[model samples]
Structures are given as C-alpha cells and as structure tokens.
Target: MAIRRQDILAAAQRILSEYGLADLTMRRLAAELDVQPGALYWHVPNKQALLAELADDLLARVPEPSSRRRWDRQLTQLATDLRTTLLGQRDGAEVVSASRASSLDTSHLGKRIVEIVQAGGHTHAHASASRDALLHFVIGYTFDEQSHALMAEHGAAPARFGDSDAAYAAALSVVIAGVRAPTAGRAAPRPAG
Candidate 1:
C-alpha cells in the first residue's frame, strides 16, 4: 500500500491520543507508522506542521452557527461547541494554542464567529473584537479545565467547581452581555474636542 499523507496524519493522531502532545515525537510517530522518520518529512515538513494539522482537525469539528437562533444564542452555542471539541481529545487545547502561533489558517473559524457577532448589529471592529475575546476565553478556559482534570486523574483534589460546564456557561454569558451592552440603546462617548 502506498504511504499517503492521510496515513501519516492518522498515525500521528493516534499517537497524540494515546501518548499526549509531549510524547508525539517524529521518531515515535515514524515508529508508529513503521516508516523512517525521513518518510514523514515528505508528508509533513516537521513535527510542528503535524501538530498544526492536528489543530486544524480539531477546529474543523466546531459546528457551524445555527441560522435560526439569535446572534447571542448562536455565539453561546459556538462557544459551547468549541469547549466540547477541545475537551474531546487529550491535550487538544494545547495543540490548538500552539498552532495559532504557527503559520496555520485559523482565520476561517474567526471569520464565521465575527459574522455571527456582526449579525447582531455590531460594527465590524466591535464584532471582530468580541469574536476574538470569546475565542480567547473559550481556549483559555478549556485549557485550564483540561489541565486540572489531568491533575485530578493523578490523585490531585477535585476541581473547585466540580466541572467546567457551569463555569464556562456563566463566563460566556458575561462576555456576551458585555458584547451586547453597547448596542442595547447606549451610545458611544464622543471623542474629546
């Protein structure tokens, strides 16, 4: 059978799932695929590229916004979906955060999010800011939650809030309210003359 890029990615993902990001080395991945490490280079330039691919795969799982819902509700659902997707895999949030710092195409997700906010009567700048803030919150919150869960698995104390769902929901509500406030019949202050 021909060694395809997808084959390499699949093996890489399996390694990531079983061993976590810290252990996902080129040597280990090559061993997992029963190929020379050089062979992986033909498919992915390096380990960072492979990680970027994994991060993209995770983001791709985020469900599109529902058109029938109000903008704030859609944003809420989007944030919830993001958290769900990040928590689905071991070290998923780390992969995403690392990829964001790499040369990956994460703008599509951001564009969709901004569109949702814009639909709610926000200016483009405001929408973009709100979208970024929400994305940052979701990633940061989930990353911390997953890290603590890992600690708990190793016999650390249970999480203070029991789980992240309620905390995340409350935080998301605050962010959405802040984003919606300026548009809800309050005008921006004029620049000082």
Candidate 2:
C-alpha cells in the first residue's frame, strides 16, 4: 500500500485526538502508518509543514460568508464558525495559533474575512486589522475553552466564565463594534430599550 500524504495527515489527526499534540511526532506517526520515519518525510518535509497543513485543514472547515447577509452579520457568522471549527478537534486552536506567525498560505479564509470587513466601509488596513483581531480573539478564547475542558477531564476545577455562548457572543460583539467604529459616518448606534 502506498503511504500517502492524506493517510499521514489522517493518522496525525487521530494521534492528536487520542493522545493530544505532544504525542504526534513524526516517529509516532510513522509507526501508526506502519511506515519508516524517512518515508513520512517525503510527504511532509518537516513537523512545522505538517502542522501548517493541519491548521489549514481545520480552517478550511469554516463556513463561507453568505452573499445575501449584511456585512456585520456575515462577519459574525464567520467568527462563530471559526470558533466552532477550532473547538471541534483536540488542541486545534493550538495548531492554528502556532502557524499564525509563519508564512503559511491562509489567503483563502483571510481574504474572505478581509473582504467582509472592507465591505462594511473599513479602510483596507482597518479591514485587515479587524480580521486579524477576530481570528486572534477566537483562537485565544477557544484555546482557553479547551484548556478548561482538559482540566475538567482530569478531575480538576474548570476555570470558566459565565455561559460560554453568552461570553463568546459578548466578546464577538465588541470586536464587531471596534471594526465598525472607524467607518466615517456609518457607526452603528447604541441599542436602545
């Protein structure tokens, strides 16, 4: 049987889920695939490359923005989808966060997010900043969320905010507001009773 890149990635993800990120080394992955470590290197040049691919895979699962929705609503949906995807896998947020400072190609999702904010009347710089802020916020929040889950799994006290949904929504609202605030004449009004 040919040892394919997809097979290696699948095994890596399984290792990540079953044993967490620390246990997902090339040697272990090779053993899981019944291939030699050198053979795995042909598919993924290095551990960082493999992790970048995995992070891209997770980001690919985020739902695309709807063309019919308002820009703010679209941004909201994108942020929510991002958080859900990160929480879907063990240590997924860590995988993504680790790749952020690298030159990996995240243009697919990044382009769409910047487009959404730009459509909301932000300057290009502000749009890019907003997208970065939202992604960073969600990754950090979900990392903590998963950390709490791990703590609970080990019978330790879970550090938690109020309701997860409410907290996320509130924080997301702040991000959206900040993004919208810089538009010259289109600042959203405060909610009234």
Candidate 3:
C-alpha cells in the first residue's frame, strides 16, 4: 500500500504537536506511520521537501484581503490571517520560516501582499522590505503565542501586562496608521497667493 502525501503531512502535524518542531524526524515519522523511512522517501523526497509542503499547507488557506477597508487595515487583516493560520498548529512558523518561495501557496501570498503594499504607494524597495517586516511580525507573534515550551524551559510563564489581544491589535493599528500613502499628508493647495 502507498502512503499518501497528505497522510505524511498529517502525520508530521501530529508529531509536531506532540514533540514540537525540533523533534520532527523522518525516521520518527516513519515509525509513527509503522513503515520504513524509505516509505516516507517515496512520498517526500527529503526533509526539506517535507518542510516546504508543510509550510505550504499552513499558508494555503489564509483569507483574502477585503477591499472595503483602509489599506493599512487590509494589511493588518492579512497579517492576522497569516498569524492565526500559523497558530492553528504548533510550531507552524518554525516550519514556514525554514522554507521560502518553495511552495506555490506561499509564493502566491507573497506576491499578493507585495502588490497591495506597492499599490498603497510604497516604493518597490520599501514594499519588499515591508512585506518581509510583516511576515516577521506575523511569524514572531505566532511563535510567541504557541511557545509554552519556552516558558517551561525558563521555569515560568513570562510576565505580561494589559489585555494581550487588545494590546496586539492596538499596536498593529498604530503601526498600520504609519504606513500611509504619500498623499495622506498632503493638504489641499491653497488658491494662488
């Protein structure tokens, strides 16, 4: 019998949830599947391939940005989409950050976000950098959200203040406010004086 690609991904997700990203091993997955490691190879060529597919799976289902909102709000929603998807399973960003542009899903999302940022009047270079910045923000925030292992290792839950969700949303609101089009600040020209 052939092991399916989705089965491989599902098994990896279970393993990741059970043992976190660092403990994910093809051999361990094979054992979990009750098959030889070569069987995994039959479905996935290597660990890098597996990681790419896993990351793709994670990034694939994110919601499309809404057009009726402010540009910054659109981006915030995009960031939230990225964040929530990554947080749905443990160590999702760990897998995603390891593979960039290797999957069509991630590639499409990257292109879409960059396009919107550019349309908002950021220079191509700024848009590129901002895209990376947004990705880092989403990944880092989600990592922190899913990081009980770090707390355990450090012997306590890290001290935090304020309503965390509100704090994050508020901070994002401020940051988005700052990422405005050049025309945003232009006052209407006065009559010739």
Candidate 4:
C-alpha cells in the first residue's frame, strides 16, 4: 500500500509525544512507518518541513474564534482554548512557538482576535496590541503548563485541577484582570496576609 501524508503526520505526532521533537528523526519515522526514509521525502522535503506540517496540523484543531460575546470574553475563550490544547500534548507549545503565525492556522486565529478587539471600540493600534498581548501571554503560559505536564508524567504533582473549564476560569480571571484600566487612581487591592 502507498504511504499516506496523514499517516506520516500522525506518526510524527506520536513520536513527538513519545520521544520529543529532538528524537523524531526521519529515519526513526521511516522505521515507525515500516518504509524507507525516502518515503517521507515525497511527502515532506526535510525535517523542518515535517515539523512545520505537524505544527500546522495540530494548530488547525483549535476551534475558530466566536463572534458571539463581549470582546474580553471572546478573547479569553480563544486564549484559554489555545492554552488547553497545547497542554494536552507533549511539547505542544514549543512546537507552536517554532512555527510562525503566518505559516500555520495561528494567523487566521490572530486575525479573528484582532477583529474582536477592534469591534470592541478600541483604536486599531490598541486592538493590535491587545491581541498580541493575549496571544503571547497564553502561548507563554501554555509552554509553562506543558513543562508542568512533563513533570507530572514523571510522577510529580502539578497539582493544577484537571477540569478544563475551571482552569480557564482561573487563568482568564488573572489575564482579563490585567487588561482592565487603572481604577481612576483608586486604592490598590489589599495584599493578602
């Protein structure tokens, strides 16, 4: 039977999950697929291309941003969804950071995020910065979470709750709180004892 592109990508994902991006060599992939290493060349030009394809495929699974809510909530939902997805797979955020927004589905998602920000009565520049801030924050946060997952796999407690909804609420609360305007020079929140 002919080798399929999806099969190659899926194999790459599995290998990345098992051995990490560093260990996923073309020869190893061929061994996994039970074919010659050259077989992958027909589907992807090089290791970088294979990595890019894997990133693209993984990022494509992030659900589209919705237009149904206040911009803050919409942005929060998008960021939280991204963080959750990245945490689900090994080294997922690292893979995402290596790939450009232009090279993967991220650019589309970024555009949607910016559109929501703009629609919320912000200036173009403000909306752009807002979108970037959220994206970078979530992506960075997810990378830390992925690292935590790796630790968890080694029998440590990340101790973070497993429920996606609750995690989102906790994270978004902090992130959205940061985005708020200064309270007209009001008193700062009291420090915890």
Best by lDDT: 2
Q: Write out the backbone clash pairs for model 3.
A: none
Candidate 3: Cα lDDT at 133: 64
RMSD of 3: 3.6
User: Model 3, clash count?
Assistant: 0
Worst lDDT run of 10 residues, candidate 4, spans 175-184
The residue-by-residue lDDT of candidate 4 on 58-145, one tens digit each, is 6677886666777778777778778778777788888877765544324766777768767777677766676677777777777777
Model 1: per-residue Cα lDDT over 9-37, one tens digit each: 78888988888999999999989988888
Model 1 TM-score is 0.89
Pairs with backbone N, CA or C atoms under 3 Å apart (clashes), candidate 4: none
Q: Would you list the clashing residue pairs of candidate 2? A: none
For each candidate in the order shown, give its overall lDDT on alpha carbons: 0.83, 0.85, 0.76, 0.76
Give candidate 3 misplaced runs (Cα > 4 Å).
101-106, 148-154, 159-161, 181-193
- Weakest 10 consecutive residues, lDDT, candidate 1? 100-109
TM-score for each predicted model, relative to the true structure = 0.89, 0.89, 0.80, 0.77
